[model samples]
Target: MKLHVFDTFAYSKTGKILHFDVLLSERNEVKAHQRAIEWLDSIGEQGATIKPRGCTFCHTVADAPQFADEVARNGYAIYKLEGCPA
Candidate 1:
């Protein structure tokens, strides 16, 4: 499966910038934005907001087995880039 990658960044409540990628099987901006927020919330960044400008379509790539498996279980998968909690 081909996955659409959305490069997303947002500021946490503590003013730390978090960089991550939202990968989806389909290219839907709305869904991508929602997924970004969901991931932020999951990582205890409930106060972080993913503005439309913050999340932009980056590129599409063939899904790896791990990513494909995760996307199948969840609606989307996130690839943490920077400033994300371990």
Candidate 2:
């Protein structure tokens, strides 16, 4: 299986910056992309998607704009500032 990392950042309820990341693997890139799409579907604009395992930073993009299409390449999905581990 190929490993993939998805990254993003959002603010906490207390105003602190919360950086989040999640790692997933699938048999191929097609499956990986599908997995990412499913995850995105599970979490709409008003919702947040939490990592089931690996990292546990909790995602909550309350007012941020859509980012997947503009930032991802080769099935990698990313959204936010640099330096977050994925």
Candidate 3:
């Protein structure tokens, strides 16, 4: 599994620095949900809110909800901004 991280920062309308991060990856999978989780974990081993995709098979999971459900409904799991497990 190959992982990638993105250095990012967020701000509020009042110019308040919301958060700064040098996101890192602990793992990578061909699956989209898994990959997204890996991304969130890299920063601090956390979970993230995931948006399901369309027809596309990933090593980690199936295509997505709409499409994936059509084919492998019980194959993959979906979530959005879920906290990481310790």
Find the candidate with the highest lDDT and give its number: 1
Give lDDT: candidate 1, residue 9: 88
Question: If the candidates were sorted by their lDDT against the true structure, best first, what order would they fall in?
Answer: 1, 2, 3
Model 3 misplaced regions, further than 4 Å: 1-30, 54-86
Q: What is the C-alpha lDDT of each candidate?
A: 0.88, 0.38, 0.32
RMSD of 1: 1.0
TM-score of 3: 0.24
Candidate 1 lDDT, 1-86, residue by residue in tens: 89999999899878888999999999988899999888888878898976667998999997567799899999899998999877
Q: Model 2: clashing residue pairs?
A: none
Candidate 3 residue-wise lDDT, 1-86, digit = tens: 22222223332334432222221122222444444444445545343333333212323322233433322433323332223233
Angstrom error at residue 77, model 3: 22
Model 2, 1-86: lDDT tens digits are: 23344443443334444344433332343443344444444444223333333232233333323434432433434442433333
Q: What residue pairs clash in candidate 1, if any at all?
A: none
